[model samples]
Target: MRAARPRRRFLGLTATMVSAALSAILAFTVGTAAPAAAATRTVNDIGPVVSSLELNKGYEISRDCGFTGVPQANVIGVLWLFCDTAVSPTGQRVWGTTAGTAQAFTAPSQSLFGDFTDASGNNVVQFIPNPSGFSCGGTLAAWASGIASIPTSSPNPLLIIPYVVMCLNGTNTRPLALRIVDYDYTTNTFSNDSPVGGTGIFTGNPLADNRILGSPVVYNGSLYFYTGLCTSSAFGDCSAGTAQVAKVTLGSTPFAAYNASNQSGGHRWLDPRNYTFSTLAATSGGFTPITPASFDVHRYPAFSGSPFVAIEQDDIGGNITVFSSSSPTGPFTPRFTAAVPCNSTTGDGGLCRAYIGHPESSTSSKLMLSYFQPSDSHGNGHVRTAWIPWS
Candidate 1:
């Protein structure tokens, strides 16, 4: 049940069609309120109103990272962001730049930051490599981590995004680092904190090397996370070739604190000891996809008239799945499924956060996915969208 533009029509209509497409997702959707009038048009025909919410066109620091959904709409001016390192942090390792100045690029020291506004907005950045030096290829691939957003402080109710780097340079054996960033209103910037938490691998924690892939989701006022084993055998694993889903709620000290740990022993919950992450088996129809070394499971539970969890499965195929969950921690059942048209193979590369949009005054939803073609260098990728009807 999908629609494809005719070759001839697609070529001629590229510009005008894009203009018309804008009508369905432009500045009419804001305040989180549904349209007053009932939708009289079919899902495909009805035009959606894009909310006033605009992505800060801050610089894309990573040659690779981008977020799915609208969790970052409120960020004003230039937004600061970070991600795992796929390549070495040294400047001499860079092959070359596609469009920008090559010398302007430097390796991310402990982490990297960028300034962005709406996609149409101008973004500026300066990369300064770590003095201690780093040890990755000149590629920036997606690594495993557990991402969550929590309130920064009282009175302002600002949000802070936390990332637990359980793997380094997309490899499992690498040690983990706990990174935190506080959003400041006065300066419209983020202040990053380092290595607040350390792993117990040396202390013989079996789960120490297992990589975490999912972001934070709220259920009954508590926070939950999804985790899985690193594809690379270098990391420690309780079980090989299997994934584990778990839940960890914010403790009493829910807000961010200096030198404080994000997880307490009682705060984390496992998947009933019987659940596994690979419910969707690998495709067996003679598809020679590249094998992904690592992946993260980002879930979008249904809301606003939709009832599916959009899981962003990176690596092989760069595909995404929509699952239905009666409870936050499944027994998650699979439902609708879609993938980026390009790079539907399980090769050495990976993709993250395929974006999905639920528009106002509409019965259908839009899914935006991104991927890099194997032939490209630096893993430079592009984004595409698909529309699915509610009826």
Candidate 2:
């Protein structure tokens, strides 16, 4: 194993001050504002896009690991990926090649490294809870931005692959860390924690640094990650822009170490601000990565209306650009650009203002989002869910 980096520390701001700043950003970014009294939800009949699974209906699920009445507590992000079964259709959840009860997936006990703010003005962190007496080997880096599930094959063996990517200390460099966790639902035990090996997998071609941004998704048997570079650009590196939609297949050969040059789709990297990168979708030949034209905007994208990739980008004053694509990588077109539903003049207080967390589509066509609602600021932040059912 390579020598691990030193533990990162938060400086300049006290925990309270840092927490406050995060809460403010969340308020403006994902927080909720009071909609007009006559407000009604926009319904779309986004026609057939993907396989019609009955799982698309939305249901409110628990966020933030069920910590009620706690300030700065809410689920901020969620991802629903594909899984295959290795077992016969025997009405059983095949867990292992040796076969047993299926392993129930669990969230980590430790929360995100940085402080997050919600619309209602509450600062929060999503953490994985450590069991009473388990000595896990890995360490989570500070201010880590995104979380994704590593795609896996073999439904009969019931494998769990969870990966957490964290940016570098005081920079946006991600030395991508991966963990292959095996959960035994019957015994409720977890093992098989390993660091994703370094820079060897991309064929020693040097995977772009500081490109880890946005949530990750899996399609066509390969795990795809979206690169942001927004944070770096914010720090004044305008020349450093390389947005990427990259993928690697599920195998035991250490994906992070796989040769970047050996992969298909050509590591489609671009400028996050200059060009738009669509999420990866499976194609007949391989995977397709879509790019949008200038004067078009797509931001905070999530799977919506089943099979359709949806994004809402802020346009010129009072306008928001919303786009949808049936194919993950696509010749995508625009849906509409409309006024934001929430008012942003005087600023909404509390964590409730941050209503937009990470948005995602479950394999069953259901849409899930982690954002702060009206009650989130004073320990009332909520992780809410909604659905767009199309005939």
Q: Best candidate, TM-score-wise?
A: 1
Model 1, C-alpha of 189: deviation from truth (Å): 4.7
Which number leads on lDDT? 1
- Candidate 2: regions farther than 4 A off: 1-153, 156-197, 200-210, 229-243, 252-308, 313-322, 336-370, 374-380, 388-391
lDDT of 2 by residue, 85-188 (tens): 11111222211111111111111111221122135422222322122221223432222223333334432223233323333333333333322334333243
- Model 1: worst 10 consecutive residues (lDDT sum): 8-17
lDDT of 1 by residue, 290-373 (tens): 111332333333344344243323334434333444554444444444444444222322333323232211133332222233
lDDT of 2: 0.25
Once model 1 is optimally superposed onto the true structure by TM-score, how far is the C-alpha of residue 28 displaced, in angstroms?
A: 39
TM-score of each: 0.48, 0.39
